[model samples]
Target: MVDQKTPADAAASRGRGGAPAIRERLTRRKPVEELVAETQAAEGTGLQRHMGFWQLSMIGIGATLGTGIFVVLGEAVPVAGPAVILSFVLAGLTALFSALAYAEMAGMIPASGSAYSYSYATIGEFMAWVCGWCLMLTYGVSVAAVGVGWGEYINELLHLTTGLSLPQALLAGPMEGGLVNLPAAAVVLLSMFALLGGVRESSRLNAVMVVVKVAILVMFVAIAVTAVQEGNFAPFMPMGMAGVSAAGATLFFSYIGFDSVSTASEEARNPQRDLPRAIMFSMILVTAIYCLVAFAAVGAFNWTGFADGETSLAGILTKVTGTPVWAVVFAAGAVLALASVVLVVLYSQTRILYAMSRDGLIPAAFSEVDAKGTPCINTLVTSLVIAVLAALVPLGPLADATSIGTLFAFALVNVAVLVLRRTRPDLPRAFRVPGAPVTPVLGVLACAFLMFSMSLSVWLAFLAWLAVGFAVYFGYGMRRSALERV
Candidate 1:
């Protein structure tokens, strides 16, 4: 017994059905098939797959197309002038770099955790936990971000219909000197009830909502184009590239939800093929809409007129058509659009948390399924948290924070593709990023450039968030992780 083991014996022990050394435990990669098997084995309890190509595509579009165009265009135009169109393109290009990577990974892994799950199978357990933490920030905070936008537009509808505007104190959050954001809180609660109805029902509702919102945007493009003034295009780059970059960084938050499509891996009818298609299609459609809307907005109205972007489209419609009728209609459409965002993104937030829970990184209740084939406890808890934030926190800084977290998650996803390709070249990929190391490398650089464009305050806030995540991981996830028991 004391004779000791050979190198082969030592290596064999590492692959045995048990936990290895602490260092090995931290870096252990969950096998791709094992990831799918765990979900398949729990068939009765796991999330059911029902969504087809169009439904999956709607989830991405519904979530990705809101707020960015509805509310952000107003905020962006003031900074970038007519160049805001360029900002939208820049952000879309940055997102495309990462989206290609997401398509490759989603086709291979097809797990609910998305980038977090992808990181686990390609990177390691520890990195996966941190990635999940960033995703929590991305989806959870964006719910509140879009909810606040919903509240703003709902107020616009009220003002248009009855000529009564809600007081600033009632509409704004505490940071903005308002006591509570009632509509913001109300929208999230409504979305929670919708989720409790089950994924199929919710997806149907989201698809209808998506159709209405997209039509509204198209109406804006048509009506606004009639009033386009060539004179407005004279100083297109007034603020120059610096302003364009800043606006692009801010607008990056708008592109966060396309990844929500990947989070549907376990719910998609044919994730291996459909997920990639949905993600790419959503990006192209959303980007075209963004550019068209920005172009029409600046052309139809002076960039200086976008003083308050929350209701920019409605204002532009009113100014162009000279009637509050079209404005009211646009405002109503925005209410639908932003609500759709809350619904789809809330669904995404729950699924990501559910994935983390199954890995033993969080409470088990999140992973538990209800009779309706949904995570009731998880949905209820996430909705409540997001509702509170929507009611109390201001939107600007939170939106920026969401962008940074989203970019951080996307950058890691690009890295994961490169890692997996090199480590397991034999793994089958239904979709592949064309240029590999070079493409992913550029994605990383693009994300980093945009991140650096943020103000120092945003960086400080993000680092504070990362610190708390590290604390949670070391204190609980490390010891309780499912891998530790393997």
Candidate 2:
């Protein structure tokens, strides 16, 4: 249990030597019981439980499906050749490990904080802060990254339909020789408006978009698979296993938001019953669709041609059909696909901050909700910040940074599963990761394996981000924590 540190308890701890007292404070775990109590405590004034299995599944599928399939394929195919299909499979397996652990934790804890709250309940405060910090980077920056991808398809759509596209000055960031990415900024703000309206409405809209995008991809597969050139499959592993591993690391960004379903715990009507099923089901369905698209795309077009960046899959559709109509249709689908990603990821970002702020780790403003049970101030402020990042940051750096942070967070979650199983054996868990120590151990190793594939520059950026997080914790969260103040 997370014992509240009264003045007397603090005094007693201080008497037991300074170093020991500090260590005790840092490793303090929050009780699962109390976490649930707080959920009930804030119900009428905080997030409402409006999500079901269907809405939760949409959160995972919408966030994962179209983002990487439509955007990253152009980048990843060049690196891994036709074997980019294997990269998708490799990335999917890595995500499966983490998803199993997430299912167990969501069943036991059911907190909106996602991996952050799991760490707080299983490990301690310091680790929880680290996980929350990484999640902030993972979800927030990824929304911007996907927003930039949204701009790519929007430009493609205009070019296909009207023979005119937005100029470079309005299409990219300073690093890419453009003034600002206007479409990126515009889409994020539009998603923000949707979020501020309410969670149920936002989710319903996302479900519709998910159906549309799926149909579009299925249609592409049907048309493109028939035109497969046998020569395209030769020399598949051009750059070899290293290239496949590297591409897998990059493609892993696509799987980043599947766990957003776990983050929706507090908003789900039956978290224990629905969250676990949704996580596994969504991951399986998305992986099947992703691998199918990659296989069809590679078979239909020479892998080398993907490097040309002509919106590969859409371009392939147009090539096979002998018309630009398919490209236009595909581009329209991409717009909706990426917009769905922005909505789900942006929603995850706000909820994680809400949990942190409620625990006094950040400002209390983040925890405040309006009559409709939305964090009005939190949504607006986060949306504006993300919109700025989308507008000013280049997609490459944003994507690399997001993947590193997301990998770190997923590794921590795997460790949390091991920690909780040993520490809280009596806790009632609705779902369980099958292989115990072995499974959770492999999950951690798999996450680290992919994380090692990133470039040195990306690793340096990850360390710098962590350094800043530590500063914030010591400067603000350390003393202001609710565990201490209570």
Candidate 3:
């Protein structure tokens, strides 16, 4: 007669006993204590922690200051008029609430999965998987969106400076009535190769590019200040509070990349101290820059003027200075800056995949690190996928989809922080969100509000994307989960 075990005994065996045990384990939550142990164990897995606070902060800035200000502003300013300045502040505050929650989670978790890891340890595997799925869409599509934005500015710069342009078929995506976005695809590949060179190299390059990005904005502001006519301030709130809120929802994408700082927790020398500082610092710095740029652009010319241009900043500079030369320079800075955004976004994407793979939720090869201590395989794989997206999809829908995914992830993270505080009060946390439940509650509400502000079409696209994610999780991820194997 075959030996049989009771269900309790089998469940007590941690899912290693048999198929029944494994299936039972699928419903089991990964305890906070176990996740902490796993994170400690991963330190010896060949990924090095070489980043400091400043480098990590630059990564946040480099990632966040790209397409939102450079491209989206062309559309956003028209919605809020001169009051777009308030939109940036409101959006920043919304992001700050979630960023604070993230800082607390990063301090305690010190893991690569960002919100996914936080949710897994505090919530359950299903929620964790959902968070990871949302993030995969957020970062992956964000990289593609930024790449396409870069391509647009580059083509615009060339047209303004040299009277030359790439063929429309090579510049636009199929959705935009073109064959493929070759320039967008090329930028994604470039960022991939840069990442393959290793983290320190990429960080240094990002730092330099960030400086260039900042300098161009400062120069534009200095010039725009001289051109400021009091007349532009007349219709400051022409669109009123509703418009400001709507523009805030649109500008929320600008703040999405600040969370990328926490994704580098596994790669930071002192994540507990550095991660929190980087998150806050990056958010504050980027917010100030955004406010200044919005003020300068709308002050220099009527906000109405910005609606007519493709590259808002560059166009503003050209109009103020009465020369195409400044616009070309601004576009060059934007191109380089947007490339850094792609680099950091792709970096976050690969690292998130690395963390998921290490958990056995995906293929193990993605977790494999190279001699240089980089997830080169994951980077290569992510590059191919994102490159295809950039080449084939239009920028507008991709940006909206990314924003919705990010808002969902942010809401989940806030809930994770609240849950962990109640469930595991004993866990050591280097940082904590002030105001406790209130702060996180606000974060949840704010993210939900922004998410709902998206168009019905965007909602449909987001739901369709999530439906596909769920199918993938059940079909592939569930069976191969490391917890099930255990």
Candidate 4:
């Protein structure tokens, strides 16, 4: 009775029922310091910490080398003719520049949030939320896009091997009167479960897939390069610079996953040391592969035949080799590569949301961890939305939107490096971008140029998304920002 009579005990008990005590309130809604502290405490949680430079390089390759090379080739070759090779070089340059910028910013921050986190610390709270939102939508839509792409190729492979295939109406989108894209939805669901298991497992899976993808391309290249007739490259730029620009903009998607490697900085064993090397290595490797593939694909087929039909590697096999077997293999490769891409993009999307949630920009549930220490709630919500998208919508709109969002994010990251250097000279940087002002400026210009080359419809849709993002940020994120409380 005497012990229960204390005023301090009663006040503490009442505090639990009222608003949380000051310490509890502050802890739950973290300030920047608290956020940093929490992240530090949870070091080496989702991803393993022993990843070496070689593993990091493989991760970059695994992320970048898929869907882009196998699939985008069919779409890009017709745009620029043989000069599509040059367009690849152009896209590679922009990716490299942006990657350099990301390397510097990511190293300095050494955090899990990727571009969104860099923007938050350097720019402001509002911009960070906008970037985070855009990253989510970009990667989320990419999952659906990749899944749908995967279904098409997988069906092609089954028919090739078994001499049986599903009808178009059964396999295609609702607009095409299909009930649902079953295979595409299946791949997304499967990838989600794989990711939920753990990051290390996913990385190993990606590494194996990347090796398979590279080996297939190497076989195609080795066989096709010897067959190059001089006449095929005669009218190299038949469509000229306009065509080159269009192709560069389209081929830009091939380079999409390079930046994604940077997204794992928070999980990297030695982010500052390894991130730049990984980004550069992946870009150089993919650029060389793309150029070689473009050369081989064009060498084997006449330019005129491309105008008559979509110039896919599979189509080339059908035309030049007069055999359906190679076509089947190319299509099978596309299916596998696209499936891997969907998995990686979806993983990146959930992590970005998890980061934002932890910072109080979104709902707290997004950051909540299950027994596995994965953001189970965020993963489920993201995968479900992507699966629904795959089942219904056509892929064209979402794919274009994804490219625009990526270019915009990349441009901001380049600028972010410059901004940080000026504002926080004292911050320890694990990596520094070589050029001070000029390099980042060129990076921004290159990205902008590619962005303008995109369809006008994409620009309009992007603007609309941006406007909505601004509204959301001002209305909710601004007041709830953890940075503000700090």
Model 4: per-residue lDDT, tens digit, 40-126? Answer: 777645433555666677767766776566666666777788888888888888888988898787666656678888777666565
Candidates sorted by lDDT, descending order? 1, 2, 3, 4
Instruction: Give the per-residue lDDT digits (tens) of candidate 3, residues 456-477.
Output: 9999998998899889888988
List pairs with backbone clashes in candidate 2. Answer: none
Worst 10 residues of 3 by lDDT: 15-24
> Can you write out model 1's per-residue Cα lDDT over 363-427, one digit (the tens) per residue?
89999898778999999999999999999987788789999998999999999998888878888
Clashes per candidate (backbone, < 3 Å): 0, 0, 0, 0
1 against 4, candidate with superior TM-score: 1
Model 4's alpha-carbon lDDT is 0.75
Candidate RMSDs in Å, in order, are 3.4, 2.0, 3.7, 7.3
Cα error, candidate 2, residue 436 (Å)? 1.3
- What's the residue-level lDDT of 262 in candidate 1? 91
Reference-based TM-score of each model? 0.95, 0.97, 0.94, 0.88
The candidate, 2 or 3, that scores higher on TM-score is 2
